[model samples]
Target: MSMDLFSIARSGILAAQSQLGVTSNNIANVNTEGYHRQVAIQGTSTSMRLGNNFYGTGTYVQEVKRIYNDYAARELRIGQTGLSAAEASYTKLSELDQLFSQIGKAVPASLNDFFSGLNSLADLPSDLGIRGSVLNSASQLAQNLNQMQSHLSGQVQQTNDQIESITTRINEISKEMAQINLELMKTPGNDAQLLDKQDALIQELSQYAEVNVIPLENGARSIMLGSSFMLVSGEVAMTMGVTTGDPFPNEPELTYSLGGSELKADPAKLGGQLGALFDFRDNTLMPASHELGQLALGIADAFNEMQSQGFDLNGELGQPIFTDINDPVIAAGRVGAYSGNPGTASLSVNIDDVGALSGSSYELNYTSAGTYELKDMKTGAVTNLTLNGNTLEGANGFSINIDAGAMAAGDRFEIRPTANAAANIGVVMSDPKGIAAAAPKITAGTGNSGSTSVKLVSIDDRSAANFPVTDSELTFTLDTSVNPPTYEVFDVNGASLATGTAAGTPPQISAFGFTFEVDGSSGGSESFTFDLSFAPGDNTNAVAMAKLSDSKIMNNGKSTLGDVFEKTKLDIGSQTKSAQVRAGSAEAIYNQAYARVQSESGVNLDEEAANLMQFQQAYQASARIMTTANTLFDTLFSSVR
Candidate 1:
């Protein structure tokens, strides 16, 4: 019937109009970011029966469906997060690498110059001009170390500032996300624009930290940061903040709070820009600072020890050429107490042997009364050390002394023996006469009838209980009446200090921190005596100090001063190279993921144009149906009239 025809034509027209509208919308928003292509779905309407024969009722639009793939979006987010982290790490590490590569050369050059000055002084021990030059070189080396330490400390502070700024932005984003969730819940139908805005915010948030999105039945979403902390839930958001860390005031820690309750976020799980900054500060920057400090400590302490065992131009015992290793301020800074400690315990660290230092930090935790455990921060090795009275001795190259109060069982302290050495090191001796260029003891033959000579090898320990005091003499007499030989040693007061058989390859005698070689091969009675007399022209101590440039006195006697600096440089270079490689790989992955997402959900102008033409043609065809049905209705009316 004409009536049925009119109804069918009307339905067809409505369906075509809907399709045309959808196509036009897609074309209009072709360049809009975060807009997904939409499609109008068509379905057949209910049929009509007349005389046992069914007839179609044309078509109607079912729904306008958004084109999106959740899986693809998730993969894109993951790729974005990885790329952000890699790039952040590479940027920071490259700066450090470049710093060490450029300014780092000054340290090695200064070290060489200092040793060269020492050699020049050794060639002419009594030259005041040479001594002054040596002192000048020494001062230059200290200044270089101080400058390097200042730069490294500045990097640490900059990193902390970045962390704080990022945290504030994250908190702002969290609040905005909460607002979006509330809007989604209040909205009745699916708001395509609102959903697009939500997704855009999520993508932005992923740059700072890892994010996990969860969909709710009420059309709202929940966002989790680092896959653990809930950043947004329904209408509420958690706040993130940074605070000064315990034990180390320069370090910063991340904190989370919600509804007045504080929560802790696992630092390792924060794998994005935030995580990269934290890693750089803790692993790369801090370790490099410590290594440089260790090198400074080794140099300063070695020279100071040599000075202590020699005499100056005025025949006085030499003082420290650099600041004292155990100065009160320096010692107290080596230990950091945890802020949560209930006891009033205070501790100080003293560098007992510079050569034995490992360039690592340690954690001291009290387990019981007068009992503690020391853990190496680098290697994670733990050692049990018991407090003997007020001191704990033999800790790597250092000793811990209780300065005041007692510690509770759960108290903890961070011990960093060499962390501040570079910053605190200085050239304390200004006078050229203070340089120790002569040996403390002078040896000679006491009316010997044999071809024998005495040469002082080294002063092993000046603090030995039986060591001779200053201005004292030691006498050595050899008796060949025995098969091999026998020796007797006596102090200045005619008291026998030691007696032993002088039987060796070259026949040497050791006593009271002094090793002397007595060659009695020309078979005759030999006698020698050594007196504590200052020889200003002697270059014995200067020669020994020059040898330190090549001496393996660091890293438990495995690395020299130069070796330590080179090793530190190599470590930073290696890390920078690794970060660059990782960043390249991440970029490749991110590009692939972005392409996939664009293909799946992104709008295409060409495709949308084609769809628009198809829908337009369909609209024209449906309009023709309406025209035909109207004409047929007019013809039926005329026939009836």
Candidate 2:
């Protein structure tokens, strides 16, 4: 009986020792990250039967189990991913917003200053200083646009660098995960520390891209991005790579592979920092850059065309005020073929309607044999086109002419008409004397015997006007036989053109490039003559240039230049604000998930301390039983002797 008591006391002592060790371990690692609380479970030992009665044999310790909730872990990962994406998006968008909010030398401000300079020139049409101011303002505006485009390009490059860096980190993590999977398969479900490390690694990976973890047999896990872009499966890890050889100011394409087979996954499927960066680069930054280029191109082309129609102070046809894109298509106005494009077709594009242009890039690809597809990168709208002998007419507000080459199957092209206009624009006319501020001259002839006076109005159509090779004279002969004196028009050769009863109205002249207004009536049998001559001091062209500030010349003439810029600013502001709000919400959700994990698996020092005391007392009692059993056994032996 005493022997049986010794066996019972021994089991109690061992069970207490194990429980105490577990309690101590919990207290020690209370501050350790990713460490779940552990508990030592004890069960009753096998019974000993004597005389048909079963009795317990102290206790046996089961496995030390770590407290973990897989659902909470998943929620925590998702929340953290959301927070990371939102924060990344907010950071980039805020930078863009601040960039557009330039204090004085911003694009909009420079544009306004340019118009103001034009208005000043209109007030003093012949002043050289004012003309110089106008020229300087134009130059400054072009400089401002150039600076903006350069900055945006820099940002794009920076974002791409970050993307490559992030991808590298993700690859490293995935490789580690594969290594861990191999290690775990050797001793499945025994390495609690290894499991903890794997969870931590997964959390880190989620910051760069969406992660989905699937537990397989043998306690191994597979890491996937988006839906099926597996990073790791069993002991294999897929590698990620970035493709290069594209032009500057554009991001390289992303590539994925498993072992050695190349894989393609849509970037949109990603959801963390990687996804946010891709979205900012493609959706926000690219479009905004293209829109700015569009504005610059539109302004330059419009002003240059107007200046061409007028005469400078030197009485010569004005030169181009701004150098525009050479062919109004492709990035930097240069044709682009896909890096691996299977085509030799060279493309040229013309802007049929500037106002109809949208701030978007396009993708041109061959759908099949002798067929092409045009897609708007921003909207994903597709337009089908037949080959039509290498000309695509009236598509997307532009005409595409393909020449001197043939296309192979699966060829692709990228067209960014307005993406680099700002960078390419320049002040072509350096001389202030080249600024056109005068119109064709008109004058009234010296010989007239009537109360009627004539003044020259605008020459609406300069191309159709038949200006005489030499000075031409227009004579108005009147007849007082009618109540309202009738008049007959005669050219320089006295050839009668038209005869009509005169009234108080302006009459358009077919011979000259102008119209005339007669305020007073002609006397009986009187004659009036007028001639057209050059006018160097005219401000009509300058005034017309100044009016472009308020003209609806963008968005199919539905928006002004200022309106497009304002919309851009507002869009950036709205995106920044939305990202901030989403970040806040995601942070809150992450905190809550963390709290849930903590409540379920976190160690409690006070509770561990209490457990320590209980186990200590139990240990002491079991030791006392051993002592008592030993003493009783010694007494029995002495009595028997």
Candidate 3:
């Protein structure tokens, strides 16, 4: 009986000791990551033989379990992932802030300065010094654009390299994770080290791109990239690659096809740090460079074309500010380039707006296989061309393109038929055609009416003046004295040509396609009237009577003839000002999210210390039971002796 009693006491003591041990362990490892508090479970042992009443064996350990909620663990993972993405996005976006902050002197600043210089020139229209200043400033503006374009192109190249590096990293990590799963499947239990390593890897991977992770039966996780690349599956990894910057400024883009395989945007998916960088390079930085290029190209085209009309300074015009892209379509399409012409009117190429063009001229020359390239003179960024066009419902310039997808917002462009020389007309039309013979597109009627007639001397058909490139033109000339007189040059249909004054000097003559220059006449505001004309689609006008005293001009100073040239210049300084503000806001949001997540997951030593006390008391109580059991056994032995 005494032995039986001792056995019961001993069992109780052992059970209590086990409970204490569990509590102590929990307190000790409170700071250990991924360690859930464990509890020792005790149960009554069964009797070997049952008679009247079955009250037999003492106690036995049932199972060692965790004092954790399964639901809580799942919640933690969900939150962890959310935080991971936020943190990753924030980290990646931070780089954009840095990049934008660094984009100086060439972008917005130069743009604004360029226009301001134009304003100064307009203020002193006849100041030779100011004129030189205007030219120099214009040239400087182009230089800034070129630099900016080059910078953006560089950024694109860097982004592509990053994409490659990111893909490689993801691939390696994915394979490692896959292997871990296989090893885990063969093993009896989970390997904590593998789990931690996988977690660390996931955190790292999230920085570059967003990912979807699925846990397999074997304790392994499968990784996918942007629903595109199945980076890792069943212990295998598929890698990704990238093509660097475009070498041609006017071309579109080329994808980094994976060794002649499909374009892998998955492992190379544009997201996380990669996405922000891509956006900056393509959307922000790249576009800015392109705009700079556009501005440069536009001004160059304008000034060079005008130089043929004879300006104030140099005997001849200088070279184009930036180099043209190597593409035949540029000189072939609606916005085709013009070389030389002796006609009184020369060609004028005026872009409707810079925002209207694709990232570069390459979109017009997208390759059949959907591979094309264009160099960014600013950031030197290169990107793959998705799609684009100069007109709505535009054709698939490249066969592998979506049909006139969506026009990017802020886009603007137009190709008005222009003349070739200062006094040369480049409109392919020599006269109205096909509609009414011996009739004109526009006719002049005497009155207070603003009707001006367009006369095409050698009419092609004289019927359909409602067109461009038909070789029909109005004959005109310029004066070189004070300044060129402003003339409203009209088309065959009496529609305005791209706005500018008629040539102002050297009394040049043209049989066809001469540029409109200013007339050096009474007050430099002469209006040369044309004869009867018809047909439509012309939109050119003289520098619409630029009067500084006009209240409209003083209020905003834009959209008018005088301010037209000024409006088109770059605005680098203004752009930078706004970019800095945007960067600041993004930074704040990132920091806040980061702080909130850390507070919840981090360890607190003070809380653990408090838990230690409770476990110590339990330990002491269990020790007393062991002493009582031994004492009882000794007393029984003494009696028997």
Q: What does candidate 3's lDDT look like per residue over 517-624, in tens digits?
A: 221233322234333333222111101111221212211223322222233233333444454554455456545543443344333456445645654564465456
TM-score of each: 0.85, 0.83, 0.55
Q: Point to the candidate with the largest lDDT.
A: 1
Candidate 3 at residue 620, lDDT? 60
lDDT scores for all predictions? 0.85, 0.78, 0.42
Candidate 1's TM-score: 0.85
Candidate 2's TM-score = 0.83
Off by over 4 Å in 3: 1-50, 54-135, 191-200, 203-211, 227-229, 234-263, 266-280, 312-611
- Per-residue alpha-carbon lDDT of candidate 1 for residues 537-622, written as tens digits (9 for 90 to 100): 98888999999999999999899999999999999999999999999999999999988989978878888788878877887887
Q: Give the lowest summed-lDDT range of ten residues in model 1.
A: 516-525
Q: Once superposed on the true structure, which residue ranges of model 2 sit more than 4 Å away at CA?
A: 103-105, 245-249, 327-335, 368-371, 384-391, 441-533, 637-641
Estimate, for each residue in 1-641, the C-alpha lDDT of model 2 and write its tens digit.
89989999998999999999999998998999888888888999889899989987788897888787999989989988898999999999999988888631388988999999989988888899999989899988899989999989998999999989998998899899998889999884657787878888888888888889999766679999977588898889888887763533357767789668876557788899988998998889988888888888778877886786566887555678898555433422534677677777777666656778887778888867867788887789998865555677646656667855877778787777676788878898878988988654334445545466544433444443444323566677656445555678777898886777645434433334544444454554656565434366888888988999999988888888878778878898899999899999999999999999989888888889999999999999999999999999999999999
Q: Rank the candidates by TM-score, best first.
A: 1, 2, 3
lDDT of 2: 0.78
